[model samples]
Target: MKNQVSTIYKQAERFAEITKTAIITGNISRAKKCLALAEQLLITGSNETKIAISNVYLFSVSSFMELRHCSISNLFPKSLKAEYIKQINTSGV
Candidate 1:
């Protein structure tokens, strides 16, 4: 169990590194992938630390907000509106 947790931690760290690189290089696609992986790992994490989850949620909300504002109004479907609503609820903003 310890080993598994360690592996997950390492994987999360790798994802964090990738996220950092993506941010530095302005590579949105890689950043999105890294952020998604980071969210998954954090979801399974038993660690008490919550910074990872918070970071993921904030980043994801920011990304989606940009998408909503930048793209055509028709691009975001009504079905996905609930997802964004949930996000806004979780973010408390």
Candidate 2:
């Protein structure tokens, strides 16, 4: 359990870095990677730590959206936003 928690944090940190780079580069691919990694970690991580994981995921998504707004000429996918919101709500984040 402790190892799982550590792995989750490490994975989240990597995803956060990827997301930040995506924000700077305006690269959807990088953002996708971030989202993928974050989701994978959350799914594999312990239920006991889900609240914290969900909070971090929410923050990353919001950060990505803010950057998207600043750099992109068009909005990001609505479904992606919806998914994150759904996850957060379902997870009680």
Best by lDDT: 2
Clashing pairs in 2: none
Clashes (candidate 1): 0
Candidate 2 C-alpha error for residue 66, in Å: 4.0
Q: Per-residue lDDT for 1-93 in model 1, tens only?
A: 654535433544545556566756767677666555545544565664334444443344446446546431222333233344566688798
Candidate that scores best on TM-score: 2
lDDT of 2 by residue, 1-93 (tens): 654535555665555666777767868786766656555546675774454456665466565666556532233344445556676587686
Query: Residue 22's C-alpha lDDT in candidate 2?
Result: 76
User: Model 1: residues >4 Å from true position, as ranges?
Assistant: 1-11, 45-93
